[model samples]
Target: MAISSLQEHPGSEVTVWMADGIYPISEPLVFGPRELGEEGTLVFKAQQDAQPVISGGVEISGWIKNSEGLWEAALPKELDETSGFRELFISGKRAARARFPNEGYLRVKQAGVDRRTNFYFQKGDFPIPVNLEGVELVFLHDWSISRIGIQEIDTAADQLIAVDSIGARIPAFFTIDNWEPHPRYFLENAPEFLDADYEWIFLKSQNKVLLKLPQNVNPTNSKVSIPFSQGLIVVEGEENYPVKNIHFEGITFQYSKWEIPEKGYSGIQACHFDPRPSNEGWAVVPAAIISIWSENITFTDCNFRNLGGSGIWFGPGSKNCKIIDSSLKDIAGNGIMIGEGQDRIVNGQPWWKSAPEQVASGNVVENSTISQVGSQFYGAVGIWCGLTAQTAIKNNVLFDLPYTGISVGWMWSPEATPARENIISGNHIHEIMNILSDGGGIYLLGLQPESKVLDNRIHGVKVNAGRAESNGMFLDEGITGVLVEGNLVYDIAKSPLRFHRATTNLVRGNFFFSDDSNPPIRYNTTDEEAIEKVDNLFFSEGEPSYQKELSHAISRWEKKQRKKRKR
Candidate 1:
C-alpha cells in the first residue's frame, strides 16, 4: 500500500528506513519503473546503528529422535516437491549433504558401454542404498561438475546410469582418460551415505529432513533453517523506461535456494550449464538479487551469505551501477555475475547492431570481500563478467573458492562484441582453483579490447587432480588487446602466466616468482609474437632463467597439444 501510493504521487526523493529485525518474504520483492516514476530517486536503508535482515529461509522445528538415533524434523506442509532445497543451516552454520566415502572421491574405473550417461565404478566403491529416491550422483570432470539422479545401479556390471547426460556437451568431459585421466564422483542425499556429523538428507516422499549432529548436540537446542525461496529481490525495467537512482544500504540478504532443472545440471564453466540433451541453449544458475534494465542502482555496506546460488547479478541493460563496501561469502555459486552470454543476448544485439543504451556497461564493484563460494558447484567462480564493457572491479579480497576467482569475457572468437575497456585492479586473490583445474586466480577470454588487469596480488594457486594445469593467470582463447601489468603472482604449481590460443595481449612490469619446475610462462599452441613481453621481472630459485625455461616450455606444450589433437 505504501509503495503503490508512492508510485502514484510524484516525489523527487523517497527513503524507506528499515529497523533492526528479521524480515522474511515468501517471494521476491520486485521494483519496476513505476516505483521510481520520472526523475525520482528511491532509497531503502537500515536505520542508524541498526541491522536489517531479509531472509528467504523457514525455521524448522518439531524435531524428534527416531529409533535409529537420528533426529528427524517434518517440514512445513506448505512446502511441496517444488520447495525441495539443497542446503540446510543449523545455528548459523551450513550443514553438509549426506555424501559417501566421507572424504575425497571415488574414481571411475571405466567408461560405460554408452559413456555419455553411465560410468563403471571401481569395486567396493559403494553399496546400493536402501532407497534411491532423491539420490543424486555428482560427477567431477576436468573443469565442470554434473549432478544427476540415478536411474539404475547395475551391480552385476559394476556400472551406474544417470538420468541424463553428464557434464557438458563434449564427450571427453564425461568419460575417463579422454579429457581427464580419471573422473571422480560421489553419491549424495541418501540416508545410507550419512556417516559423519553435521550431515543431513531430505526425503521428498516423507517431506522431512534427517540430520546427524555432532556428538552430544541435541536438535531441540539448535535452530535449523531451510531455504525455501529462490529469489529475494528483483529490480526490473523496460528498454526505454528504466529503473533509476535506487540505493540500498546496510542490509543483509540470506538463505535463498536453488533447484536443479528437470533435465539435470550439465555444467560448463562459471556456473553455466547446458540444460538440454541436444545442447540447445546455455543457462546460468540464478542469483538471489537481480537487477536488469536498470541504471544508477547502488548497493552499499550490505551483506550476502548462506545463499544457495549466486549472490547478486546485474544483467543486460544495466549501467552506471555500483556495489561498494559489501561482503559475499558462503555462497553455493559465483559471488557476483555481471552481463549476459552471447547466446542469451538481451537488450542488445551483435556489436554491429547493438545500441549503446542496450549494452550493460559502466558498472563498479569496489572495496568489498568475497570468500568461500562454489560450496556446491565446483565449476563456479568468485566473480563472472560476460560481454560487458567498462566494468571496474577494484580493491577487493577474494579467496577460498573451488575454481577461478575472477572471470572476464565470454566469447571465444575474435569477432567484435560489446566488451571492451574493462578494468580489474588492486584486488587480492588467493587460495582459489583449489579443487578444479584449467583455471586461475584471474581467467580472461575472448575479444575484450583494451581491457586492463593491473596491480592484483595473486598467490597460493595449488595443483589439482584434473587434466589441465592450474595457474596464477590463465589467458584463454581469443583474448585480444588485454594489458596485464604490475601484478604480483607467486607460489603457483604451474606457470605464472599461461596463454592458450590468445593473441595481441601485453604483459609488462609484472613480478612473477615461482617454486615449481615449470617455466614462468607457458605458450600452448599460441604464437610467441602475439603477446609482447616487456621489462617483466621473473625469479625462480633466486635466479633469472625465464628465457631458457620459456623456450623449453613452449616446445613441451606444443608436443602435448599435438598429442591431444590427435586424440
Candidate 2:
C-alpha cells in the first residue's frame, strides 16, 4: 500500500527500508505489474549496515524429554494435523529425515514387472517400519532421484509396491540395467527409523515432532525451524505487462520449503520432473525466489540458504536481471535456474523456440558461492541456463554438488532457437559430478552459435554411480560454433573434454590433463573434422602426441577395468 501511494509522485523512486532481524511472512511477498509503475524504480533495500532476513519458517519450542530419551515438541496452536513438513533444521543445520539403514542405501534385488510401481528387495532388506503411514520410498536413478509413498510390501514375495508410479518416464533410466543390476533405494519418514542422532519424524496425526538429538544438547536451547511456505518472494508479470526496474539488496532469503506431490517427485534432469504424461511440458521445481516476465531486476549481496528447493530463478521473459555477490548453500535442488524448460507446447505443437519478447536473456550471476546443493535431489545442478541468450555466468565459485556445476542450453538437437552467445567464464568449479553420471563440470547442449566457455578452472570430477562417463566439459548433442579456450581442466576420472553428436566446435589453447585410462579428449558419434582442436595440450603425466595419447588412453582404461574386476 505504501508503495502504491508513493507512486503517486511520478518519476520518483520508491524505497522500502528493511531493518535488521527476521521478518517472517505466512506467504510469498508478490510483486506484479500492479506493484510497479511505468517509469520509476522500486527498491527493497536493507538499512545501512543492516542485513535483513525474509523467512518462511516457524520455530518449534516447548520441548520435553520422552520415555525413550528422545525429545518431543508439540505443534504450535497455529499448526494443525495437516501441517506436514519434509524438512527440519536444528541449530541451523539440516536434520535428516527418519530413514532406515541410516548410513547408506539398500540395493534392489530385482525390478518389478511394470518397473514403475514396484521392485523386489533382497531378503531381509525391507525396513518394515511399525506403520507405513507417511512412509516414502526413495529410489536412486542414474541421474535422478524419485520419491514415492509405499502402498504395500509383500515380504513373502520380497516385492514392494508404491502408492504411485516412480518419477521416471523412460524404462531404461529407471529399470534394472546391466550397469546397475540392482538399483539403490532407501525408506524414509517412519518413526522406527528415527534412531540416529539428528534424525526426526513429524506425526501430523499426533500434532507433534519427534526428534533424536545428541544426548548432551538440550532441546530447549536449540533453535529448531520448520519451513511452512514454499517461497519467500514472487515477482511475476504478464506477457503484455512486464514488471521492471525493481531491485533487492542486502537481504537474506531463507527457510523455504517444497513438498513432494502426491504422485511423487520423479526427477528427469537438473531438477526437471515428469509430473504428467510425456509430450506435455515438463515441470521444473520452483525456487525460493522467483521472477517471471520481468526486466532489469537485480539481487545484490543477497544470501539464500537452508532451502528445500532451488535458490533463485529467472524464469521466462526475464531480461537484464542480475544476481551479484550472492551466496547459495544447503539447497535441495538446483542453486539457480534461468529460462524455461524444453517441451513447452504452443499452438498444438512442441514449442522449440522462444518468442522474442519472452526469452530470458541478458541476465548475469557473478561473484557468487554455491555449495552443498542437490541435498535432496541428486540430479540438480549448481546453475542451469536453458534456452537463453547473452547470459553471463562469471566469477562464481561452485563446489560440493551432486550433478553438473553449470549447464547451458536446453535443446537436445541442432535446431534454431533463441539461445546463442551465452558466456560461461572465470568460474571455479570443483568437487562436482559427485553423485550422478552423464554430466560434466560445465555441460553445453544444443546449438548455441557464438557461445563461449573460457577461463574456468574445473577439476575433481571423479567416477560416480552411473552408467555413462563424466567429463570436465561435456559438449553433448548439437553443439556448434562455440569457442572453448583458456580453460584448465584436470583431475578427471573420464576425460577432460568430450564431444558427443557435436559439430564444428572450436577448441583452442585449453590445458586438459587426465591421470586415468581415458584420454584428455574423447569423441563419440562425432568425426575428427567436427572439432577443430588447435594448440590444445593433452597431458596425462606429460604432454604427449595425439596419436600416442590415443594408445595410452586405451591401455590406461584396460588397466583400470582389470583393477575394478579384481575388486
Candidate 3:
C-alpha cells in the first residue's frame, strides 16, 4: 500500500503505512518544541498482525523527539508519576550517541538507576547524536519521579526561564547569583559595574554600607568631602551623600564618636561645614555629632542617641526645616540645635573683618522628646535655637537636662540684623539642674524681636546657691516685642520668671507658684511696672505679707492708670 498524508481526529488514533515494510506512525506523535502545553498524551503503536510472526508479549517501546532531535522515552503506567518530566533523544551519524545535555536531569527518589540502555539493531550500531540546546529530558520511576538537574543554556534564555518561573519581572539589579546565602554578601563583595566615572563608591553589607574614600584624595576646599550628588553614599557606616529634593524615609545614621579637645578621644564629633560668613571658611570645629545641613529638609520619627555632641544640629542656611516626632538623648552638647553657627567675628576684629553674616531663618521643631543630656560637669539645653529668625520650639517634652529645656538666644551675632522671631509654646519642661549656668525651663537672651513664650509647663528647676542664676523663664537684655503668657511655673528654686534689660514685653496670664525659699517672679533693670500682670495667679494666698505686697502692686498699677487717664 502506498502511504498518503493522514490527519487524526480528537480522541482517535490514526495509522499510516508505506510500501516495502517501511511504516511511519504519524498518530499520537507531536512534532515541534517540547514545552508545557495542552494536556494530552501522544501514543504510537505498531500495526498488529502485519507480519507472520507477531512480536506478542515482546512489546516494542518508543519515545518522543523534540525540536533538537532528542528522544525521550515515554514512561510506563507505574513510572510516570510527575507532570514536569519530559524526555528527549538525539541521533548522530556513524557513531550514534544519546547524550544528555546539562539541562536534562530528573530528581528521583531511588538514587541509583540505569540511564543508558543497550539495544542491538540490524544495521550494526546506528549512531544517534543528541542535540541538547533546547531539549527537555525526563526520567520516571515506579510511583515516584525526581528532577535531578536543570540546564540553563544561554544567559538570555535562562533569564527568560527564571522570569517565567517566578511569574514576575526579575529585578534588574539584585544578587541573583547568591540566592542561597544573604543577598547583601554579593552586593558588598562585588564591585559595582558602572559605565561612567563615579568618584564615590558604596559597598553595602548586611547592616551598613562602607564608603571607601579615594586613596590620599584630600579635598582642598572642605574637610568632609562627599563625592556623590545623590543616593546613599555610605561613609564609614555614615551615609553622607547629598540627596537633592528626594524624601529619604526611615534611614538611621550611625556616626562614630570622637572625643572633644578636652575630653579623651573616641566619640562622634558633630562636624559640618558652613559656607556662610564666607570668611569663616569651613567650620570644621565639631558642632554636633550628626549635623544635617540640607535645606527644606525634615527629619520625622527618627532616633538620635548616644552621641558625644549634640544629637542633631542644623546650620544657618538651613531653612524651613522640621525635626518632629523624634527622640534625642544622652548627648554632651544640646539635644537639638537649630541655627547654632559660629561667630563670624573672632575677637574685636571680625573673622572676615566685618560683621557676621545674617543667620538662617524659618526653622520649626515640634513634638520631640529630649532627655538625659549633659554630664555632671558639662551643661546642655534640650532645644537650643540660636541666631535664626521665625524659629519655633513647640509641643516638646524635655527632662533631666542639665541646663534649660528650651533656649533661644542671639549668642553668635549680637547686632541682631536677622531679628530672631522665636516662639516657644505648649512644651512640658522639668528637672533641669545646672551650676554656674543660667538654668531655666526656658531662657531667652539678647535681642529676639517678636518672640513669644506661651503655654509651657515647667517644674523642678533647681539652681545651687552661688552657682547659677535660676528662673523658670529668663529673658535677658535687648529682647523686644516679647510675650510670656499662659505658662505654669512651679517649684522653681530662684524665680518663676525674670527679666533683665528686656523691653516692650507683655507678661500676662501666667500661673507662678514657689513653695518656700524661692520668689514667685522677679525683674531686674526691666520696667516691672509696665509688665502686664493681669490674670497672673501667684501662690501667695496663705501668706499675708506676700498678699499685701501683691495688693500694693495692684493699687500702684491702678493709681498709675488713673494718672494716665488724667493726663
lDDT by residue (tens digit), candidate 3, 328-418: 7655456777775445554565332243333556778887888866531134567767667888888788988756778777542234556
Model 3, position 494: C-alpha lDDT score: 79
**For candidate 1, which ten residues in a row score worst on lDDT?**
344-353
Residues 181-232 of candidate 1: C-alpha lDDT, one tens digit per residue: 4578889999889888899999988888999977699978977998888889
> Candidate 2: where is the Cα deviation over 4 Å?
81-83, 170-173, 176-179, 276-279, 346-356, 542-567
User: What's the CA RMSD for each of the models?
Assistant: 7.3, 6.8, 34.0
lDDT of 2 at 48: 97
| TM-scores, one per candidate | 0.93, 0.92, 0.47
Query: Which model is ahead, 1 or 3, in terms of lDDT?
Result: 1
Per-residue lDDT of candidate 2, residues 126-216 (tens digit): 5577677788898887778888888988888988899867756643445544347687889999987888999999887788899998889
Cα error of candidate 2 at position 222, Å:
1.4
RMSD, model 2, all Cα superposed?
6.8
* Candidate 3 RMSD computed on C-alpha atoms after optimal superposition onto the true structure: 34.0
For candidate 3, the lDDT comes to 0.45
Clashing pairs in 2: 167-266
